[model samples]
Target: MTTTQSLPHWNMDVVYPGLQSPEFAQGFAATVKEIEALVQLFDASHVEKQDVLTVDDGLIKTFETAVEHFNSVQDHVLTLEVYISCFVSTNSRDEVAQARESELENSLVKLSQLDTRFTAWLGSMDVEQLIAHSEVASAHAYALRRAKAESLHMMSPREESLASELNVSAGTAWTKLHANLTSQLNVTLELDGQTQQVPMSVVRNQASSTDREVRRRAFEAELAAWKEVAVPLAQALNSIKGEVNTLAHKRQWESALDASLFANSIDRQTLDAMLSAARASFPDFRRYFRAKAQALKIPQLAWYDIFAPLGSSDRVWEYSDAERFIVEQFGTFSERLSNYAARAFSEGWIDAEPRAGKRDGAYCTPLRKDESRIFTNYKASFDGVSTLAHELGHGYHNLNLAERTALQSFLPMTLAETASIFCETIINHAAMKDADREERMAILEASIQGACQVVLDITSRFLFEQNVFEQRKQRELSVEELNGLMLQSQRDTYGDGIDQQTLHPYMWAVKGHYYSSDLSFYNYPYMFGLLFGLGLYARYQQNPEAFKQGYDELLSSTGLDDAATLAARFGIDLHSEAFWRGSLDIVRQDIDAFCELVQSQA
Candidate 1:
């Protein structure tokens, strides 16, 4: 049977069978009514008074209950939004489908005001009084603090209302335009002596092909195609950053980075420690890259050639084989995680097929409150199997957090990758043990590619963002200027080991992470996730049983604590270099084995 046929359906019936269902429509309508009704009780001046604790408590409880209800409304809509758009995004020429997507986003955008009003209400509260309220004290201690942090930067009620409304049409609308434009841009490639219109994802993926000519051609074509839209992309970025920086200043924030840090609930010290660990391990990545360049018989490694396969692996895993492999590898780490994966696959929870209109990448969206729906475009390759493991890891993370109150289940970005990267480590290590000499090279090379991107490449992106902010303080960057910043960053991180002549200049145009207005410094979190996960995986390997319990406890605590405190449970001092070195040590072993395997073949 096909993978789709065997896969289980996610449980959406608990909420509603469709958007038109009474429960779904009623919930959405009720959310609108609640937001509209809040205006009667909303008064900015009331928040400053003391002894109004009873009144404040009622407002806080009402808001929390309303929000909990609204989350289900939005979550259900988003599930449909992603499921439907994933199909449409795969096919660029479907204008009607694309129009429908715009409508869905517009409806969501209209409710953006609800969030603004909610924030304003929270801000108006007497901080001391808000803290004293039982419902506020328990459900949203962290959120309350974060809200206060932001509320200070906000304008008064009238100005804040105007700004929030303008943002939807100005900053948000421009970013969406950039997305729509980029998504429609198609690249034509010369494959097997025939001209084929390849999706952008396929073009990029093929840049990793064993054939050097194919790799170079794909990179050249992809970048050239992106060049057409680079100017607009640059404007999109500049406009968003301008608005963000201006707002930060108005709020009396020192910088956009400071504002983001407060919102993310992460300290600058933790960020510094994470960056220090990544940079210190740069040599390990450089060594791995140099080895790959040598194996490929290239004078210097170019950006496109980084993902080139090193040796042959005739192991073509079917979807079923990949499923079993992931389950077995996860079982070796923690049976709880393993059982979660097993049930997800067996219970029809995944949409795992390469269909015509399916989305480009994989993600796990939770179903109502208890389950998750995973989408995958499986190409039956090694990377596909790894992607499956990664997404399932996210599903299990959601499963672990499902029991938490609606308020507590929101995991921070840094801890978000814990499960996904853990699953990757497990599958990669298990596959390494039994593969033949050639397959070993393929596996090791693949491992290095992922590590370098997560470590070295992310470092470059982080540097680029830092440069953008520093320069933004002086003047806006043009397309050419942004390209220069991106390339300079590449040279800095990749060192003399890379062929600078063939570096990717269109990175600013292609990567959505950089363009996201809501998040700043989106790059470093990947490094944190990988290194932290590696540390957890190392612990698991040392004492599979004892560490398994420790690992679960760590994951559970992630939603409630910071990185340093969470790592403490595992006896890992995240502030110390020793913990980071322990993680990098795992990478070193793999690099050494890969070098040996390549030399033996030579």
Candidate 2:
């Protein structure tokens, strides 16, 4: 009965009328006041601050009130930032959006120091003693414990403050420049005796074309575009990593990876275990890749051909049809998830159209209180449909945790993909079940393609970034050196599975991961999420009833515990190579089935 034709754009009017709106002015002024209030609360000279900090007769009441005010201020600041982000993402050429974004960044420059001091002070408190006597303490007990654990490496408040202020111009500016260059850069793809200028987003999406010629041309064009801008991007990567290395040293952390581990609420042992398993499982992955090459009638799979479509899986989905299908498919798993998808579609919570100046990738931004906005370049493909499911999965996760306090809602990135991947799996499985043989082959090929990207490609990224953090400490690397590093990483991870001559040497220049100073090694988390999510899916298959019982708790507890501890609650061992190896076993089985189908039909 629905007559929706075009994809839904997000309603930012509810957040603010516009950047020039008086409502925005009021929120900005209020935020400034709140920031000052929270910052002054941590000032030791203030008598009321001392009384509020101490465990006195009125300490519980005052401290609870203070935390509420702090959260309110943080929320307002974030709301404003999200508005700018949403606007700038959709209209990258809007200088006003970018300016306001920078203004908000400047306005909140004091946040880091304030937050560090507050967490450090909270760490110093008798959290157990306070929790026993205060209801508010009971609510934020885990966050306090986590803050105490993280405070082990807290720099002097002044030092932390200096680092925060320094990053504004140093790391932040470099990243914005990188973003600006990539978003605006156009790629010229020559095809069918004609050349077309397109955004990098569209050019990259062409890698999934069923036509081998188109895919190859798109890949070459993408590399050429990146080559033109690689030098500055190389410098950006070096400066960002160099800054992180310097900051990590100042904080007295053992390594940048150690700091990243702490931020992800995971430990080194788990990372080693995870990587070890991934490395050992490559034989199965190679088998899948080789089968894909066979399906494509190629002797060896070229890097450009990695996403080349195989079989008769050329179904182009309409946006509205995808919305309905995804909602119904989600119901197969949980009514709650299905309901969330329904709400997202009925309400305007998605921006799913390709446009000039729009960002390249898709993401779900969970706002607050059962609301989220999904951004995607939805071109009406099954893959786009799957992406919609993935993002909505994240929204559903947010919905489940909506009742938690602000601090408790800050889940680590490692577990952030759980619900999203789970939802994707559900939709993929449902599609495969109802699909014909050739379509089924396409589904299997698509699944393995995704696995390869996460497991193998992400491994290469982690290695490349780790090496850069080590080398950039000594000196800046040139564009040629960065390319060389990327080539070697691709070769090491892909081995002979990918065509050596056609490997993408400019991948480091194109990836957004290399530029994040705080979020170093953003690569391996994808591998972790993909495999771990499959492992959870396998468990659900075996015992849907029992698995469903603890699923809610698992998602809700993500912000409260370390990755290892949280997995342990579900009887999964994150520190064991066996656990991860077992997870990949699911992929191994899928490869077996896919290869069998290809050979059977050949």
Candidate 3:
């Protein structure tokens, strides 16, 4: 059994000794001072609300200095934020870290105000002429042009500043409330013939247990736990979405999703194409689900059975085994990647234990251009190994962006998953190559299960969030109403594959994605990443050497262009239904293989 004592806690000391340490205090104070200096520079240059239509030497100089100083200030702010988040996320009850985070957020409001001023000033200028004259502007031309376009959607400077300041207490507070509540939430369950109270993350992890009774009990306990906090979580969801809806309208967005599309650097057409393909592939996913149910000797699958292991594997993948396997598989793709994964392991960059007060789910957060930290509730299964590889992929992506400025490295959510999913594919494919029949079946089932969540389950989340946003426009939804919406979404996407009576209605409360005010519609981006990464993997198979030469550059340039432009570099038409269908075809093939394996065993 994996315990918190046995698993690694990340070495945050490398970033700072402690949140209250003298070094951290000095750094935090300096970051505040730097932000204030940037504001002074903006004021001195008269860069706010300027209506300059021409570019000259003085203008070029001001633009260059502002861009450089802004980027430097952003780096400092992000470093401090990420450092504090390391503690807050791992232990939600950390009052000191929470207080510091709030303080940092308050300081960041000024930076946000400065950004509004800068965007308005840049939007009013002759951006093309500025780009032509200034090296900094030219390097950030894509971002500048996008910012100028976004300026059309801005409120007045005062309103924008007020919104930024208000968000520190409004949206930010709600988001933090949900995080703290869920992280500390526990579920009562019976394990080893004794009753025990376990963290929600631990209970959730049992959904993949070999024992059906355990999965069912955990599911019930998990639902009850969520129910206990449903009212507040519902309020959190409503407040966040309500804020987003009001702001979207104030900014002249067609809807909240319209704003998200702009933020993700993708057009509606691209999203439509991808989602259409995903919906069309639902029947194929349903087929896989039915086959898995048959293998488990059930008429239909419960939500708990969705992640259940389908075949026996004698191999138990402990943390060390996962580390070694990921490093080895990554080497086959590139030595650079393998070395990076190895370094992540040796340097204690991963927190891989599920404990009380620790948040559920896994994420890879970049600490700097060259370093990242991965958090996961790792189980002793291949699924755990695959997750580790996925996060290392994110770290590798960060490394590629090391040469770019912070602004230039800020990739959209759609493209952000590219490297992680690609790395996960590498590990999955490698694992299946030499496995025995049973092991192969297990690996194939695991891979298909993951893809199903990205495709089918994520579709449900997308639907749920969309409905919430629409309803939030009128009034806040009751917890029961929210539950009903979740169930309806599950039925719509999962169809007959999952048992209707056993659908998970509290998923809205389970997922943290809905609480984020800055990023809406976070569900579909995972689907985009998976399909896009699979498409890229197919290309690599066709021409390994050619793909290798350009892969890192493509990853590096994600922030430099929109999704369509970046996709165009490899002859991928993001708006084409055929391109999306081709990617879904890859997943369909896996579904086919899974069905065959299940039938053969039966």
lDDT of 1 by residue, 240-358 (tens): 77777877777788888887766555678777777787788888787787778778877778888887766763456678888899988888876877898888888767776543333
Instruction: List, residue by residue over 51-162, the lDDT tens digit for candidate 2.
Output: 2255665666656876786677777676777778888888789998998888778667887667777677666666677788888878887787887677768777678778
Report how far residue 244 has shifted in candidate 3, in Å.
0.4
Candidate number of the best TM-score: 3
> What are the lDDT scores of the predictions, listed in order?
0.71, 0.81, 0.91
Q: Please say which candidate is ahead in TM-score: 1 or 3.
A: 3
Which tens-of-lDDT digit does each residue in 338-390 have in candidate 3?
99999999999999988889999999988876888999888888998998899
Off by over 4 Å in 3: 1-5
Q: Give the RMSD in angstroms, all C-alphas superposed, for model 1.
A: 3.9
lDDT of prediction 3: 0.91
Off by over 4 Å in 2: 1-5, 44-62, 191-193
lDDT of 1 at 180: 68
